[model samples]
Target: MLNTYAIMMVLTLIVITIVISLVTRKFNSSTANFYLAGRKVGMLTNSTAICGDYFSAASFLGVAAAVYASGVDGMWYAIGFGAAFVPVVLFLASPLRKFGEYTIPDFLFARFGRSHVARIIGVVMVQLICIFYLAPQMVGAGNTWNVLVGVGFLGMSPYQTGVVAVVIIMMFYVAVGGMKGTTLNQMIQFWVLFTAMFIVFALILINGIGSYASERVPLVNPATMTVEKLMAGEEGSRPYDQAQAVMSPEAFAEVEAAVQQGDPAASVNVVLPQTNKLHPERTMTFQEPGHRYDWLNQFSMVLALVLGTMGLPHIMNRYYTNPSGKSARLTTLWVLGFIGFFYIMSSVAGMGGRKYVSELSGSDPAIADLTVDGLLLKSDQIMPVLGKLLFGEFGLGYVAAGAFAAMFSTVGGLLIASAASWGHDIYENYVNPKAPEWKKVLVGKIAVVVMGLFSLLVGIGIPAIGLDKAYPSLIAMMVTWAFAISGGAFVPMLLCSIWWKRTTRNGAIAGMLVGGGGSILFIGLNILKETGVFPAGSFGAALGSLAFPSIFIIPLSFAVIVLVSLFGRQGQPPYVNSIWARIHGTDALSERVRLAMQEAESRGRA
Candidate 1:
């Protein structure tokens, strides 16, 4: 039941988006244009679009939900996401663009002896990572739709409607306009999401979310029921924690007085130090970190995000859109700025939602079922619920549109990535090498539809399979798993392929098998453990600690690739010298490398 005003806004956005895609349709005459925008994209535009593609539902909704639910522990996602680009800038961006292929598989095949074996392995890995990444965006879209529209469409639930709606809409644009259209849409979507977030952030600050005091700020324990006082020397030290201690008027008064007086020995029972408008006895602070992660999990999660950037298929594909290696390098600088600002705003929105919901629960205990610890029942609902509570229906509409924009922009990029891998890499290279440009484009469009449908089906099954309930924040958890797999499987091999000439096709294949397969197995086992299929014993606990497996899986992958390469005794490709010059040398050198690659392809080596 969307109101008239909200429906109009959403429909208006859809119409405008379709128009933009149609206008960009002429740019898809060849595989190069359809796949990489003819490598002519400028710096700022590509940078913004890359941000759009990189900031999926995980960044839009999951990050805020995480902060709302877990406090400072949540901001680690923002930090790691932004920090990921550092490695990209230093090692991958320029080399990837200079190598200049439609997809990662294309680059791998050309770099590793022009073997279809390497390309096939890359295609499989890309599909796995993209689909895993895509499902969360779909889930986030569904959650936003449930809040904004909350109506069934054509016998579909709100979540189902969202999944189908986004897939179809995004597929239309991607299949019709290809890389150029998707890039334009991503750029526009990023601006829309950023502006809407800024408005919400400003409104929350203006409305005084940080100005009130709370006497009972809720808290949760991640492991066992272990509670400790926030202050160093409280009266009752055993279990008189902040949340429980605030219930005692005599104890609370003494603590509150000492805090108010700013005594040197007085300790504050707060995590973030923000005013809790809902209750007078409790306050929020930003200093807490162990709410959701232990030391090992924290380090592993950061490792996954930091290294995963080099391996994300949709993200890496954007570098190919830049005109040159240098342009790609420059684009990353702008991306860093854009992503940093977005994450900062994400923290604001999360805390604002926490404050708002706490205020609501303070006024009425009946709303407690709708929330947990002053956050939504489903953590992903934080931003959407805040939209209506903070600014009414119009604000809800605006943020909901932004949510969909985040989904559409990322899904469009993913669809294009799948298309490039399937159409250019598999179809043209294997199934139909003599296919015409039009045929190849047609195949790509078909791939988009197929992949979109497949992703939609997977998204629809998330709630039924209990993934939404098993994970704290569905989008973040799923996205992190995708990152773990990417970091484990692709990063090591990619780095070796570019920086080390001894990398062989067999070694790359072995790494993917051992590292990627092991990560998937561990993730599956963790999910089973989380879903109660296995008892939580000491061994189970240790397995749970391996939730973020990239810390171990990555090193294993690097070891396998290196060990196999050293022993395989396969000589480097004939074009390795030119490839090296292209990756590390000038655009002139890149041109010569491209000519050499073409000569290889003409000789059937590619």
Candidate 2:
């Protein structure tokens, strides 16, 4: 069976992960090693590791799926994801590394006059973002397994089995390996996923099924498309016309049967006509905006992703592992290059899906169920499905394994981030300040298990709540939610803390509350509206239309920080000058001095 080859590839990745964890266990004897790999990572290695951390299922599967399903609108996900690192490299990477902390909260606590309030808030935000981000990766895991393995273990559905399997493996490896093990695993995993993406694109080009120039044409026409308009029985609607054009009679019959049943929850894959949300009367096409977002959301989405990278706890934590600020900057440059190439290939793969996947319709009943005309019903399944269609079982196996690699690498970083925040930021500081090193490491490992389980629940609950159906590409949507939250809550506060010496503790806390709190409120309401808890024309639905809240929230946060600092009775921290010096100071000079002293000592000893 095809599942045999895919399962073998996935199993090999797991085995390698476990081996790396076991081999690197000894390096995790101290909190520094466990949390930050002793803060000695080089530029190139750390860049790759950061890439592994940054490119979650959202980038690997979601980006391509977005492109495949939404056409030009989907390409924004790739652009946003790739462009995010620009802000990270320019503003945050060097200074953050130079400040030298184990986690984001540690940086916050130190920067804000050792304020416990700031640290606690930072920890809460980090955990929240990690959970939100982790859920999508878990969803990717389940979806991949459902498509590739097509079976379940121990009475669980195939999706549930995938979720449980990935969580268990992540908990074990992350708990045992610590940052050193995670770093090594992430490095290898990044290359594997990257190679898989490149090969898939290459195959698409080789098969003559894809071309760069063809991306501009409309994927489906509005005139004959059978979407919500057709289902609603509007005047002049021909529901089966578009489906009939591309589908065999057998496939068309199944679609008609599903539509005729009139089950509200049931769905049949059918090409939907695109509308220009920005300009209602204008025509929609593959090359224009409006398939997914209007004018407002187009800008909001970009702002969320660009600013959000600076606020991501796992990503900022990787900067600490760099030996110096300069090295951190260099690492980010490498990351930009690596992810840039990856996103380009992902866009190509998405195009390939649009071009080739429809041909498989009606060839197999099961495959037909997943497609409408030529587009996949669940777009997230594009990578693995495209692989199978391209190179038989071997391509499926390789791409499926790459999907697992993307999840594992990202989930590992998130777990480590979660562990560091809970164990180092909270437990070490407040719970047991004098606790021994062993206890600290043990607690961190425990945190990893707990967070892993939480993510598992979220993953399973997504399908249960009908979220998977509500969104065209759920993984990318959820990831953007996480980005909005992180950007709104942390970016403004971090920018003020690092760049503005006048930022007060109260101001920082207020900014976080407004930015982060506002994001959660808007996103939560959006989810409810999407899920039909808030019916159309309701007040909640009106407010939920602001899908990406970062545009408003980020500026509001910065404004709040400035206003609070200006009006509040409390002034800037007394040691603000020292903190500024440290943040902006050159770590390169000290690193060179240390190296020179070591060289002199070695010569004298010889």
Candidate 3:
């Protein structure tokens, strides 16, 4: 049966989101209002909105899931995510806001001497990053729906239904309300999801079910498990010994049946020993470093996330909405605090899920079927499943709503960013330079619809391509791919163009192609290797094992920019000094506006 309370909560959130969009439609008369919320949002409001944009399914569900599945390694996702903003605050925030552009492409084009090539390249990077980031959120939506609603509609599977429903909802709100509507909705959505996380954490403490210290306790004793090994003559093998040790007899029977039938594709829940990837001689445990990454990848993953935040188009786009450069910096400071607390709570909740879900699975056959030796089959389902186990239907409802809110707020920002790139960056600049304000806004809405449909297709394709089965935590893994691409492509270019006076147009262009293109090439190979397209022990597999490419690609990109600028005939623009002054100078316009507003208020009082 559908949890009526949970469904009601989800529907209420959806209703409110759409209503806010409809009400804000009136404010979107110009391109500025439609894309940047008229560039007048206050510091606190924009800070919360930025948090909403930043915390996608990866932050909400995937971080906790990663912890539940990978232990010590999983905590890295939370740390990387929270630490990403440090670079943003120190380097990018104030300068980007002061320079004052509507989109990343706009910044690149102007900073690189109005080069059309730079603008086009930036647009491509923006769309690629947004779509990559958006797909995982869709996956989270589908998985959450499958667990919460447990049924299909309109001949679609529950996962498909969930993806379709969210896409349709996002398309409507983003098209109708524009940035103003998205901003208001995001601010509210941030608090809702944050509160839900806090409540779950509080409940775990109050009930005395688990504590932060409980993470040291393994859900299944590693000693009771056997290491997986290939049989001498068998074509395919099963961990029958491991399954028998941990699973109930009834569950073991199904494994036996699959093995007897020679089903090579069949799998059952089994506890197998973890290998120490970082240190080959060491024994692996829940508190160790080698559950997922080797030593090389541990550093790679952290670099990707830290540098990636500075490159994210959607997140960077929000800086333009700030009224002043100083306000933008303050906004980032608040964002660090909000997301820091949220990530800590999410980590605690992951530890709690490890204890409670394993204990409850034994008595509940339904829960047992979703687990393998007490560990969930899909880690992304941990939050909703744990909620239900702890507080019945009400907990399920609240968590399900929070999951949707996470997707909604992030996806809303993405759609707006995509629209701005196409509408303002491309259409207004090249396609129809003289187009009226109404026509420009219309094209932006059209772009939103197009991007929404594209995201839906990517969501459905993830499972079709076998990606869902390739990673232990699919949402988090896919998001890291997006981050790698962003960091490699944009961060190098942004740092050079903003801070380096010798950065020529050709240099920026070459760096972007190298950084962005190389990242995509490596990520594509990683996917092929994971999906069994490249067989084990092959050179292809070895090359594809570097999952996070940021560490390598980022430095190469910087080198390309510097070498090209120093040698190339296309030197820095003649107006480079003026551009530099604009970027580093104080915000005189903001000060004048503040004074004007105060004077108007004083006159009215007299």
lDDT of 2 by residue, 1-606 (tens): 237788898899999999999999999999999999999888999999999998899999999998887777788888999999998888899988878778888877877767888899989999999999999999999999898877889999999989999999999999999999999999999988998888798998887754434555644521222334446654445565644564557657767787687675564565546667876786666666788788788999989988898999889999999888999999999999998999999988987787688766456555665666556778899998888888877888889999999999999999999999999999998999889999999999999999999999999899999888778889999999999999998999888888888889889999999999999999999899888899999998999988899889999999999999989947467767666777886895544443554466469668
Give per-candidate clash totals. 16, 1, 1
* Clashing residue pairs in candidate 2 (N, C-alpha, C atoms within 3 angstroms): 358-374
Tens digit of per-residue lDDT, candidate 3, span 69-136: 88778888999999999999999999999888799999888787668899999999999999999999
Point out where model 3 deviates above 4 Å: 208-238, 242-250, 261-267, 363-366, 569-571, 589-606
Q: What is the lDDT for 582 in model 2?
A: 74
Candidate 2 weakest lDDT stretch, 10 residues: 221-230
Worst 10 residues of 3 by lDDT: 222-231
| Residue 390 C-alpha lDDT in model 1 | 74
Candidates' TM-scores?
0.87, 0.92, 0.93
- State the C-alpha lDDT per candidate: 0.79, 0.86, 0.86
The segments of candidate 2 whose C-alpha lies over 4 angstroms from its true place after superposition are 209-212, 215-250, 258-269, 361-366, 569-571, 588-606
Cα-lDDT of candidate 1:
0.79
